[model samples]
Target: MIEAQGLTKRYGRKAAVSGLDFRVEPGRVTGFLGPNGAGKSTTMRMILGLDLPTSGTVTVNGRRYQGTVWPLHQIGALLDARAVHPGRSAYNHLHSLAAANGIPRSRVEAVLDQVGLTPVARKRAGGFSLGMAQRLGIAGALLGDPGILLFDEPVNGLDPDGILWIRTLMRSLAAEGRTVLVSSHLMSEMALTADHLLVIGQGRLLADTPLNELIARDAANRVEVRAVDHHRLADDLRTLGGDITLKPDGTLLVTGLDSASVGELAAARGHVLHQLRDVTSSLEDAYFRLTENSVVYRTPVPA
Candidate 1:
């Protein structure tokens, strides 16, 4: 498990992260999300003890990461895939890492196989592609078989199959009771892979809640209605409440009323209803709504 208490990081005049507080529990995947320049990487670095926070603290399993004995066996992190030595063979790279931590060399091969990098174990890391390097980094993370894992943008540069493989692997690790914290810009994938979310905007905690709860909370109360007389139905729905917009194809987009109410209004207005359904926000929609104002950088609207 991982916990951060008032974790704040400052770079001279800028605060990369401020007062970030959250917990990552075991047996579930906790996703960290934010827009570009939101201090996600800075926070991860603080957690790994790679960078000291200007203020506040972060701990893994109730102790600072640097304070733990055999820290590799307690927490495994794949923050950057390009951290490995380019000239070293994949096996040798992991072997050196394991030796540094007094871990068995056998773990090197085991993790290579676990991450599906057995054939490339003898290959030079410099020759490997980004996806392959990511797998090697993942293998190094698993070499210790730590109960706590942190993967930042694990699926970056991965193909569709590779993405699915990573998802299944992360889920399986959590299923085995490991505490997993992964960060990504891909909300759709996070929706499928993570059980809980820890959203941040401008280095501040936005929301830490169950996936379903976020969707339900951020989704607009709206209905999708279809009827035989589109114009008449749109007019009637507008009279009841809320603004309406007609899609390019046909259906009317309605807000401010539930699906049932939309149906009742349509029936009362003598409109022959063809289809009516509630339109709830997806995780992507909810994430955008939550972080809309917190994004650090934005393009200026052209005049």
Candidate 2:
């Protein structure tokens, strides 16, 4: 497990991360989410001991990252795929990392095959495409067979096939009881992959909860209704204690009351109902609602 207590980082006058406290448990995939400049990368760096925190502490398993003698066997990470030596072959790169940690040479071939890079294992990493490079990085991370893994934008430059491959890999890793924490901008993919979510804004912890529960909170008490005259129904719904939003496509989104109550009220008013049903909120909808005040940048729509 990865644990952080009062984790904070400051750069000159800016606070990159402030008092972050969370735990990433084993046997599940946890997604780290934040807008640009929300200190996600800084937090990851602190967790990996790549950057020193101004205060607080972070630990993997039971020890600090820098205190471990064999970090490769403890936790695997892919913070930057481009950090690998460009002149070396994919096989050589993993071999070199394994050698540095006293890992046997045979482990290199196993990880290379695991990542499906064995076919091009001799190719120089400089010439590998972004997708291939991501695979190579993942191979290196798996070289040590660590129980914990961290990936930052692992699908940044991948095609659909590569993205699916990554999703499958993460799920498989979690199924094997490894702790997995990943950060990405793709909400749809995160919705499909992550069982838990850690959300941050302006370097502060905004939310830490299960993905389904977060989305369910907002979806509650919502009912979708369609009427012959949506505008008239909107007025009637308000009088019936229902908060209403008239969608552009002529659907009335109602809240503050259950579907049965809404239907009964509409029927009592002698109004013709075309449709009335509960509305389920998607992850994107819930994320926007939760982080509405946390966005640091906004672009005006083109006229």
lDDT of each: 0.89, 0.91
lDDT of 2 at 264: 88
lDDT of 2: 0.91
Candidate 2 local lDDT, 16-74, one digit each (tens): 99999999999999999988889999999998899999999999886789867888898
| Candidate 2 residue spans exceeding 4 A from truth | 239-242
TM-score of each: 0.88, 0.93
How far residue 138's Cα lies from its native spot in candidate 1, in Å, is: 0.2
- Residue-level error in angstroms, candidate 1, position 259: 1.8
Instruction: Put down candidate 1 lDDT per residue, 98-190, tens digits, no spaces.
Output: 988889988888899888889989999999899999999898888888999999999987889999999999999999999999999998899
Q: For model 2, which pairs clash? A: none
Using alpha carbons, what is the TM-score of model 2? 0.93
Model 1 whole-model lDDT (C-alpha atoms)? 0.89
